[model samples]
Each structure stands twice: as C-alpha cells, then as structure tokens.
Target: MSLPAPETPLYNHPLPQLERWLMALGCQQDRGDRHCWLLHQGDWDAELSLDTEELVICYFPHQPQRKVVRSFKYSLSRQDVEAAVLEGP
Candidate 1:
C-alpha cells in the first residue's frame, strides 16, 4: 500500500512565490502591511491576511455586517488557499 505525502504549509511557500501567485490572481499587497493584501474585481473587494497560524480573509470591506471572514490553516496547499481567496463571499 502507498501513503500520500504529508501536506505542506502555506507559510512554507517562499514570499516571492506567494507574491507571484497573488499577483497572477489580481491581488495587490497592502502598502501599510506586507502581511496583508487586497483584491478587487468589479464591485467585490476583499482583504487577505497572513497570520502566524492561519490565512484570514475578509470579503466586502464596505459592508461590515455582511462581510465574510474565513480562516484557513497555514498547513494547506497553495491551490487550496488560492481557491478560497478567489471564491470571495
């Protein structure tokens, strides 16, 4: 029987590679905080945060009541994290 490889953490990704992936998805880094990023498409806007243990995403900054907050483990695939970020609220 074969075993699957262990999952890799998102934080394990090099900063440059992570930045490139975000750029490819039309997300820009927040000037105030390198750990933060902003993405806008049409009327939708979201903020992404790279915390020590989690990737936090907040969607629809204008509507605090309607904003969606999602947290993903740092130990997740880049593709998985990308999907969550791009999915929006």
Candidate 2:
C-alpha cells in the first residue's frame, strides 16, 4: 500500500501547536474568553490576551493569585503564551 501525501498547513498553526506545547509543559487552560485565555502552570499563572492582531502575554507578577471574572480581547501566539505561562520574568 502507498502512503497518502501529507496535508498542507492552513494559515498559521500557532494555537494547535501552542496547545500541544502547553500540555507537554503541564500547563492547563483554566479558562478562556473570545480574545484571552487563562493558563495554570504549576504554581504560576498567566493571562494571555489577544489585542488588535497580536498575542500579548501579561504576567501577574504576584504569585498565588486567584482567577477572577474578567474578559478582554487578545491577539497572541500560542508559542508566546506557552513560554510566558511556563517561564517568567
């Protein structure tokens, strides 16, 4: 049997790829809005916001912060989000 050809990527594949990266790095999507997402990583957390047409990573700076009821537009890449959620300043 012959193998089928690989499918081509559509647009930018940052979300799907970022999802995988988050999962691998033990980051969970606690919650998400139309433009932003909340990620829980170990003892750290980050707020990913999508603004205009770019993804932005806004760190809480303070640790042990609880999730609040907030929503805002975001425009960021999963790669950046994953890195921010996993890494820190």
Candidate 3:
C-alpha cells in the first residue's frame, strides 16, 4: 500500500503503511521484536522502537559511553518526524 501525504500525521497512518515507510527509509525490523527497528547510515547507526504513544530512537555511540535518544509523538506530521529523525541526533 502507498503512504499518505508527507504532511499527514503519523497517527493517521495504518500500521502497514507505517512499516512500509520505515522500510523505505532503510530501517530493518528486528527479528525478535517486531516493534523494534535498526538503521545504519554512513556514519551512524540507530535503534528505533515503535511504542504505543511515540516513535523512539537511540543513536549509538554519542560519546563513547552514551547514546542519544529522542522520541516523536505520533501526533506529529510524518514529514516533520522524518526530517527530525532522519536528520540524526
């Protein structure tokens, strides 16, 4: 199925569309936990969790001993979340 317009709020998306969007963005769903995903880019890697209320992301090796974590409520527009998230921590 196709995704809604980028301006649409994530809460308006059906689950499958959301999953497809994530996959399109290069996220791999965790084999053990269906709600979790992993992304690896040129210089960074991140783990994403599809929680009930929000999308949570943890960027790895922020300071050698820490990770940078962020969350976006599903109420936000898909485009807004995509920009904020794919932009990295």
Best by TM-score: 3
What is the lDDT for 10 in model 3?
A: 96
lDDT of each: 0.76, 0.46, 0.91
Question: Which regions in candidate 3 have their CA more than 4 angstroms from the true location?
Answer: 62-65
The worst-scoring run of ten residues by lDDT in candidate 3 lies at 59-68
Q: Per-residue lDDT of 1-89 in model 2, one digit per residue for the tens? A: 22112131211444565444444655455464655556654555566554555455555645666443332223333344344445653
**Clash number for each model:** 0, 9, 0
Q: Candidate 3 on 4-76: residue-level lDDT in tens?
A: 9999999999999999999999999999999999998776789999999999999985456578999999999
List runs of model 1 lying over 4 Å from the truth. Answer: 1-9, 61-65
Model 1: per-residue Cα lDDT over 1-89, one tens digit each: 22123245576777676667677788899998999989996657988887878888888855455888999997788777777777778
Clashing residue pairs, backbone N/CA/C < 3 A, model 1: none
Ranking 1 against 3 by lDDT, winner: 3
Say which prediction, candidate 2 or candidate 3, comes out ahead on TM-score. Answer: 3
RMSD of 2: 8.1
